[model samples]
Target chain A: MMPTSPVIPLFVAVPLAGAFAIALLGKKTRIIPNGMALIVTGGLIAFSIIAMRMFSLFGVHTYKLGAWPAPFGIVMVLDGLTAFMLFTVSLIAFLVILFSISYMERYSGRWQFYTLFLLMVAGMNGVIVTGDMFNLFVFLEVAAVASYALVAFGTEKHELEAAFKYAVMGSVGSLFVLLAIVWLYSYTSTLNMADMALALQAAGSTRVALVTGVLLLTGFALKAAIVPFHAWLPDAHPSAPAPISAMLSGVLIKALGVYAICRVFYSVLGVSPQLSMLLMVLGVVSMSVGVLLALRQWDLKRLLAYSSISQIGYIMLGIGIGTPLGFMAALFHLFNHSVFKSLLFLGSGAVEYATGTRDLREMGGLGKRMKLTSAAMLSGSMSVAGIPPFAGFWSKLLIIVAAVQAGYYWFAIIAVVASMLTLSYVMRIMRYGFLGELREKWAGVREVPFMMKLSLGLLALICILGGLLLLPGAREFFLTQAARTFSVGTQLASRILGGV
Target chain B: MSKERQPGMTLIVKTVTRLTVGLILLYGIYVVTHGHLTPGGGFAGGVVIALSLVHLMLAFGGDVAFKTLSKSGAAVLEAIGALLFVGIAIIGFGWAGFFFNFLPKGTPFDLFSAGIIPLCNIAISLKVGAGLFSVVIAIVFLRVAGSERE
Candidate 1:
């Protein structure tokens, strides 16, 4: 392909430059900062769409940096999986930035908020696109640090406390990932993903390799907020600015955690029965436990954060099944969830914006005040719950079918239970926060701004059409090629290295 | 929001504190860059920066020291450091004509010996120093904000 395809690096560059500019120039004019950030997000969405088209037309495209080969130089690989992720990341980023134009008016330092938000987008894009391991770690830290600051942006007691806690846990997670990178470097004597994969295959299975793989898995698991290492997420995700909360719940964990694990394990480590089983166990546990914890949360964001954990469980469960159909389902859910989850969080932001409260009990009949936000939340909740016709349903169905096909009946039951719990919480929000009798204190509240409404509407539209991803053409363009990329395994090493 | 500047000797202590912190920060870069060849890496270098900042903050007090250099400043630095590290790795893609292996060789037993290793160390130090500094500043600064954000 052409040397300077805008599809690959644009995702990272746009956000990085936007972030820097927002930080420096934003100090004076909030309007320009917000406008610049929105423009970046819009450009990213266009880039993601380009990547999607490229993947569909060309299969997998590798962007070799500085016109270099691979294994020796850094390469950015754009496959179906990456394009899917890019599409999701950019779409959510665009919407979140849109929502923030209005949502952040309540918070001071609009420039700071926009700057951090753009940095976060750049980091996530970097993670999704870069084909280098060290590159991945850097992006991971960038996104993590930005998130830490964004979480504490409110600077109130709870926001600070949560941001500090999130920063500590996240740093620990990053440390683990860094250590894993060190170990991988020591094992394969390489820092590139494809080269390492080839080396691991050549080296065969050794105790050191096994240990390193386990460490990488554990570190990424913490990042993905799997059951065992998920304590920090509930505290962290809820405390951020609403747009930030949406971004975290929507894409951050999936990109930094889920996407990394899938890429490393499937392509680098080469999935085995043992590793697959381990993933299954983790997925099942996270699914069950996360939902159970979320059931009682009266705090709106906290409950949604907990639900995010449970949803991640579903994504993992499907991907862990180790079938092509299962992989497809997992990637699909990842896309769908980003849509609905971001929508839900944005809806919560609107509610928070108008009512100045997050407690469900304090909210009542907000549907009257915020018709668009309520409608968006209701649609998002349904989509998340796997109601028929919504995007969540198709992915969930595929996962259940794939599990059943894999002969894991018990796991299917777990998936169903998780689905029910998801429905329950989403329903609770609609009933208590949106539809119930009007509360006395919040009666004077009004609808959120036009930008917020527009973003929510766009996301809601995506949630409704999420199921369309399963159609053959969409599947071919977005997900199948990614699954094929992972399945291609060590061949990716040769492809990047020019058949060295 | 305002602070009474320390009378005199304490101010000297503050001056000593700032210089000491700056020196430590300089030394930290050396250790972190030489990590692959010797010992220490990004994490260790970053911690040293935080330690130096803590000393300065204690001697100079939060207001006076924090004003010139804010936590938000450190946070942005951390992010930029991360971006720089990733950016270098991307640049390495040119040499091997690929994304992930060591080039033919650099200088063999020189300051520029390990092609990407030194660069990696430098990037890590930046990220770590800024990261650690941001964390410390956030924690300490929050204390003056009524300590309720928890």
Candidate 2:
């Protein structure tokens, strides 16, 4: 049985408080904002580590706000999935903030950046922990709003245009989500996820349920940038500053998009064969479409953005298989993807930081001038391309194996082909951007700042060692436990509602 | 008249704003404080308050209105308001649990009842008011800045 712990609320609280603090006093001194951000993100990392330990030691931890019961007042839940996401979000955020300390110097309004960044982190943490659907929507909006502003932080033409497009699509997606929440509330007579799950189980499936489910699925799919709904990602992801890109690509989609879909479908509504198949179809389409479009991009960040969509497809395909192994593989891939994608984005940022260009053709033989960045790029590329001994390979292998085990040989083949496509684009990036003769215009280029390199090195190390997560003890403790949350399916509702 | 004139709208409009802005702010505060008992709470009250400030800006021009609340000042207030709200919620941790209403529940409809609800409302009003005002300030001022950049 899971115990009720108060620490769950801190995940949302710390970052929020930090955001406010930075906004309030940050203008007093430039150092105040980024320093506070680093401290807050670092604290959050520590708290998430503690939460993960608590989840393993105690079965699950639920915190009831205002000391009210679960069905009455709002509650925050800390399960294996929540713990896992917390770790991912906070880890990436901390490193990114560290990266931003020097990288953000080029832009003004440094405090504003930290404030919005923290707000985004707070929102993601809130989304991960909140036990209410409406509450989830609120957090999603918080993150979305902050991100829209962050994307336009540059205030340049393309940045503004991209931000506007992203904002419109995101707002529409949120509207759908809100509508679904209303539908679910009306149908279930409850807003809490666990209670809603029980209510849905008691009421059984209805037309209303199906409609709401599809509405939610579509909304989250848009946020996740899955194929049919992914028109905005390429523009937005490339237009934003690199750190924000890393955040959006790394954990935002997973936390707000894939994670939400997983929780609502598997736990709240109960997964069905039809829903599973729907997920698989969306996954495959997203994968194929994302990689195909990615191959044609010369803009480095745009290419990475498309690749993000493709990786998301892999995650969706894994989860859609609906088996325990598939679930595990999907989550493993989720972690690996976040690490390498963030690394890749940060690498691009480094390249842009030094060369002032994001076009792959504009950069050549940067390997000679920016040795650390090139090495980081190589590591990220290898991992993302599913090269052996790197994190991405193991996850991709697991996903394909899981697909094959589920008797979906065709999906396995598609995944393999997509993997090859991923390799081609990644290699293409390396060949043109890093390996050729040095461009004469970049003759005087230099490596990025120490902090930026530090972040890149850290992420690259994670990418290289990411495969260690598959080891026996780590696999059972970390990956399996998180997968078990979904594997248990609708029983989670009963468990949550039952109390210890 | 050119040397002596204040930087604002027509004298008549500025005079009218001077007469009513205080009343608007008062009404907003009333709505915020009475939120625990009445329908209008922080968000509504805050918007009202912000509108009053916006009224000041609209009538007296950016220079006169900004003297009362500069862009950064408004931002500071917004941040404080948010922090105040969250801090109150955290104070609940000291009582029963996170966000638990620990204060004694006085008689309903009283001015100081509902534990933290009134406090929360005030915080919300401050945030919404300042935040909205700042939005206006940013848009109004940013346009000038953007035009200058060109």
Candidate 3:
């Protein structure tokens, strides 16, 4: 069989190539750019599926650079963890690309948006598959630089302000991460991730390693926007276009923040008691603080943004438990949150698009006028708020159960309370924005176009059925393998090297 | 634009700019090579390199400099750097017996003391230079694009 290594890299390469070609050609023909983006994302989804199958059959493959032996040059490793994240990212990108086709019409410079969008995709793919710490940092910056520009795409007064805030905070976070990476390299005397993990294991708890672990924690926490570091999110997310908002809340935070944090803490530094406690406290604090802040927001997307922080807390809490069950629960919730959270944001954005306002007080009775869009929003909100039978319920249940089992009853209780807060705000949006008396000004409004409806439907479907990923064979391929990979920790190098 | 100027004022401006940029380029190379041994690594050195480009842009003009280092071109360089890094890592994964492990410590204090890490450093230098320069150029041009009338 032809090797799957190149197939894996295509997740990034296709989008990047599409983006560049579109930028050059779309300048001459507007129709070409959107079509290329859509086609490229669709291809990515296909590639992600093939990757999933390949991982299931082959059990984690590592591709070396320039025919060099392992440990002598750069390497890209594809495993269960990489498969799971690649699927989430590309599936979301697929839908968002479709949504952008129509939604971006009101805005000029669509080609630039597509260009940056693809660059961001490439960066994310780089982060997921590359097996080195330094490479991770480079990819992080790649996605970050693109997102910064996209956030400022509109160039509105607020857009500039929000982008500046996001950029500054983001740069600060990257700087901290860079500093931590410097320490890791110096201590381990290596830059590759699996090698570094082994090095940390062999070295076994140095003062410098411990100190650097804290720096890594602080930097990743900022990216994750867990409680104390979440200030820029509400402002930045709401200022972007709706689909971009969904992408930001749904996948960007997970890819850049949660995924990277876990990889470094669990796989690299080996997650000390101090790091575990730090994660748990951040989880509980974010759960309570994010939801409480969310409950008072009148702007629809802002409320969703705040709730995203709360949901992220759940994922963190699960992983922070550092058990087999905790890993399962965390990965489970990570997938679910990406689905439901993005769905809810897109719903709010649809409301904004139709009614020409984001204020909950300004919107009313859109349910009658825009049934499909409204239904998608309603389902999305329900799923995100953890109503049973929806995907969110299962993940949140797993997390809370894992927390209690881990003897963190207080953390479990906070998780439950946060769910209630999520329910309240989501219900508030449905009532004030969707179910209230119809505004006379919006009397003529209709359902959004086909592209937007399609994207929303896809996400809504995922949110409701995401729990199915936990089934036996599927779980082994996606969640179990990934979680076990993390649980295995420090053994990663031995496994990859042994393969060689 | 004001035209009247003291004799050789333009020449002085050009010389100062060149001097400063040359110093920064020298420093960037120093920092990047000594990354594993010293304080700064690929990222800091790359930024320094990019700053020199910004200096050139400011000294000459956006239009003149951008034509040479356009946004599309810088973005392509960024991707190439990222690709090269991955390529190098893949080679290490296959040959070195472990991902990112280098040839047996090698003279511990030699030029290749850190194995493939220095190579990764150079790749990152290119990426950081391209990425940061792109950001600077984007910010500058976007500001102009926003203010200009049709």
Candidate 3: interface RMSD equals 7.0
lDDT of 2 by residue, A1-500 (tens): 45888779988988999999988888768789988999999999899889888888887788888988889889888889999999999999999999999999999999889999999999999999999889999999999999999999999999999999999999999999999999899888899999999998888777887999999999999999998999999999999999999999999989989999998888798888999999999999999999999999999999999999999999999999988899999999999999999999999999999989999877889998999999999999999899999999999999999999999999999999999999999999899999989989888999999999999999999999989999999998779988999977788778888983
Clashes within 3 Å, all models in order = 20, 1, 26
Candidate 1 at residue A396, lDDT? Answer: 91
CAPRI accuracy category, model 2: high
- My TM-score estimates for the predictions, one after another, are 0.83, 0.98, 0.83
**Which is the better candidate, 1 or 2, if ranked by lDDT?**
2
Off by over 4 Å in 3: A1-4, B1-150
Lowest lDDT block of 10, candidate 2 chain B: B1-10
- How do the residues B1-150 of candidate 2 rate in per-residue lDDT, one tens digit apiece? 783566667888988999999999999999999998888999999999999989998988887778888887888789999999999999998888778898988998889789998999999998999999988887988898889999
- Model 3 DockQ class: incorrect
Best by TM-score: 2
Q: Ten residues in a row with the worst lDDT in model 2 chain A?
A: A1-10
Candidate 2 structure, TM-score to reference: 0.98
RMSD of each: 5.4, 1.6, 6.0
> Which of 1 and 3 is the better model by DockQ?
1
Please provide, for model 1 over B1-150, each residue's C-alpha lDDT reduced to its tens digit, 9 standing for 90 to 100. 224545223656866776687798777776776676677877787678667776676776766556656776776676677666656655554553322335444666666676676766776776787777676776766585646655
lDDT string, candidate 3, B1-150, tens digits: 354542223656768987887898889987888777788888999899888888778876666567668877787677666656656655554553323455555675566677777777887888899889988887977797878945
DockQ of each: 0.15, 0.87, 0.09
